[model samples]
Target chain A: MRYGGDNRGRLLIIVLLVTSLFLITLDLRGVQVIDGLRTGTQTALTPVQKAGSWLVSPFRNFLSDVTHLGRTRNQMEKLTAENEKLRLTLQNRKTADAQLKQLKGVLNLAGTAGYEVVNAKVISQGSTTSFTQTITIDAGTSSGVRANMTVLSGYGLVGVVKYAYRDSALVQLASDPAFKIGARIAGTQQIGILSGQGTRKGVLQLLDNTTQVRKGDVLLARGSQNGRPFVPGVPIGEVTSVDNSPGAVTQTADVKFYTNFSTLGVVAVVVSGSSADPRDSLVPPKPRPTPLPTVTIYATPGAVEPTPTPTATK
Target chain B: MSLRRFFYSFPIFFTVFLLQEAVVTQMRLPAGGINLLLVVALIWAALSTPEIGALTGFGAGLMMDVSQTSPGPMGHWTLVLIIACYAIAFLGYGDDNIRGNPINIIFLVTIGVVAAQTVFLLLGMMLGQQVGSVSNIAFLLAGSAFWTAIISPLILKVISFFHANIFGMRSQL
Candidate 1:
């Protein structure tokens, strides 16, 4: 509209753009000042974020319940008597029940592996701009959380701490494309490298082609030497599919992470690694296949066929 | 764009920023999550003149770049937003029909968000960052656009009213 020789606007944009590029270069060059700014911003804002989280979670849940009403309707009918009973625990505080379950799961996981962990509430999820999938936990150096420490939920590895401030830490979700961990197939020493693809899914490359990498095979973190980033025997994911190329040096598979990063409310940071690799002990029990009622079917010819249902892993 | 607006925006930006981190981040849809701060800022830009829009972008980008959850280097967002917001402002500025129509403004915002995201990804690739597969990028773009489209009208109204009151555009209100 005002295309009439806006010299000032042009000058402002040029100066800002140049400044932006310079800051980017400085950050890329691993400048300490940039890190300080980032740390300072987060540290300064953590308390405010925590307060907001407490105040806003209810409205968020209400909104989610409204938007997801249709999906929830479908699930409501499929709920088991046990889940129905659990749902009745607190009619007004159903979310608390779910969070309690998740909290227990995280604690049980840490307890099993003899990990010295700091349990933290996930105050935030991924960024608004979303350069990477991440979460901010309500734990930090004061709680013994450090950058590169393994962070896991009840289900499995959620991420590793990217930066720890005084009372909060930023976790880079395992689903980030940049996330990588050494992993092993459950019940075997077959090692591989797992990398994220920006979803719950990941890609794993086994070092050897001779060892079988089959569908449904459980994967676990193989532990770093000092266990700074990943600890041994934490369940990583299950192989969803595999690609076997004849001349390839390694085998690759599509892995679905055990932890659903989106719905995560609670997680734990392992301040210290386990004394020994727990191996496959942490592997979650696979859901047993439903058995066919052969006798009943034979007696009742017109009866419906057995329909397999996926049990809710929540 | 004025010192008065700057004084008013600091608290507004930080509040929206906190809400984004606390609540918006938790409601991640299957496609992608909404960037509340981005949408709000873009709407603010879309309703303003080029000069004001540039200033809005500068503030929003700083909040984006310095955010702890931000994975990109310090300036990627700043650079992308300044250009995108300025262009949006330039196109919609002084156009009564466009500014008066909520539909036009929302459409402008949806496009601006997508454009900014594309530029950000391209910049990321240029810097050797992993941006995921083409399909992933496409999904993210559509998600951002869809969410922004759904959310921008409300933001446009709020930002428009705020500007009218604070920037003294009583006639517009």
Candidate 2:
């Protein structure tokens, strides 16, 4: 009886130790385990998340209404002006309908493959202390919004879906410290990796200092290399200021996002598969260099084209 | 373990957690805001037996951790609260009858607030994250202590009344 009790205690200790070791290993690995755990948690908590969302929906709507009421008049005027301009542009474009359609078809074929946009309402926001800046949206599994879905607003790319439940999904915003987007300057075509600095404002790092870039330049998501995913030509933000650090090969700049997250009401979620060549389709083909004229001077008898005198000094 | 007692306690705990997450978190002083949870935990510890008080504190801390966005592992909070509760119970300053003693509640809550902040700082250090500078920590501790000292009397009175009237506990109040 004494031996059996001692053995049982030993077995219990061994089991506890092994379990702890496994957990520690899982924590150290980080990405794979966290991804799996988040997905599983999303799946398991789908019902609860949906219920919680529904419970908060009324409050969110009321708050949105009150906020929008303050700016309704200003927004209506802006919309009316925009409507007139768009109508005029549409009429002119229709006159060249065939040529425009052909161009659009060619551009669409070369650029984005089949993709569709879905709109989702922001439900809850992640707290300040949370590691990632994420927001829960109303669309989810039923809406075809899945993990890795790209989220955007009128301004540009907002984030990617980290996890999806039945009626809601968490989107890790582009402003999150861990987020990195491959981007390029719109005019200069200078490529760089845009990283979030965790400020209310964000910064993009240009890898090559030699690349000509300036403030007021627009940054666009130019896609990613390897199997990494990104949306092409999404307007990221405008460069507010540039910093050239001493002895560093790269220049960094602060980007002020056009999407005002503080007043974010409606946003569109783009449902698309990972593109192999996100940048390829978005970048306009380089303008063909103008052929240089070959200068040939023909010397006539009377012209006496300046005679080349070797050793004139002698 | 009575169903009635469980029902009453559940709402109190739930409300405390919700208030901590929402309102209290938003209340930022120049230094740091009040830790109402610590104040309540301390009052409970002072009014109960040492073992039970420690257990209650652990449960409260566990719930707080769950409702928080802390990067630390789970159960870290349980350990901190248990220690705070144990210290309060071992001091033996307040009595069961002293549950309604406003001055005594204020003194105990002040101590508990300091103790809780110290534990949080220690935990952050052990976890290899510098939450803030020493001056910032001291500012937070003093701020919370002052807030708790000012507010504990009214909270204690209400809590005592609930314990007596709703919980059917003997009128310590």
Indicate the residue-level lDDT of A249 in model 1: 83
iRMSD, per candidate, in listed order: 2.0, 9.3
Expressed as tens digits, the lDDT of each residue in B1-173 for candidate 1 is 46567568667877888778666776555468678888888887777678777778888988898888776899988888888888888887777777778888889899999999889888988888876656677888898899888888667767777767766684142
Summarize candidate 2's per-residue lDDT along A155-208 as a digit string, tens digits. Answer: 566777877777777777777666778888886788888876444456778877
Model 2 chain A is weakest, by summed lDDT over 10 consecutive residues, at A1-10
Write one digit per residue (lDDT tens) for candidate 1, span A1-314: 45553687678778888999999999999999999998998888888778778777766676666667797875555543446556544333667777888889988988898888999998877753555888889999998889999998999899999899999999988889888899999877799999989878999998888888889999999998888888998999999999988988888999999998877888999999888877778999878877654322233466676545443332
Candidate 2: residue A246 Cα off by (Å): 2.9
Q: What ranges in model 2 sit over 4 Å off?
A: A1-114, A225-229, A273-314, B1-173
**lDDT: which candidate is best?**
1
DockQ-based class of model 1: medium
- The collision pairs in model 1 are none
Report the poorest 10 consecutive residues by lDDT, candidate 1 chain B.
Answer: B164-173
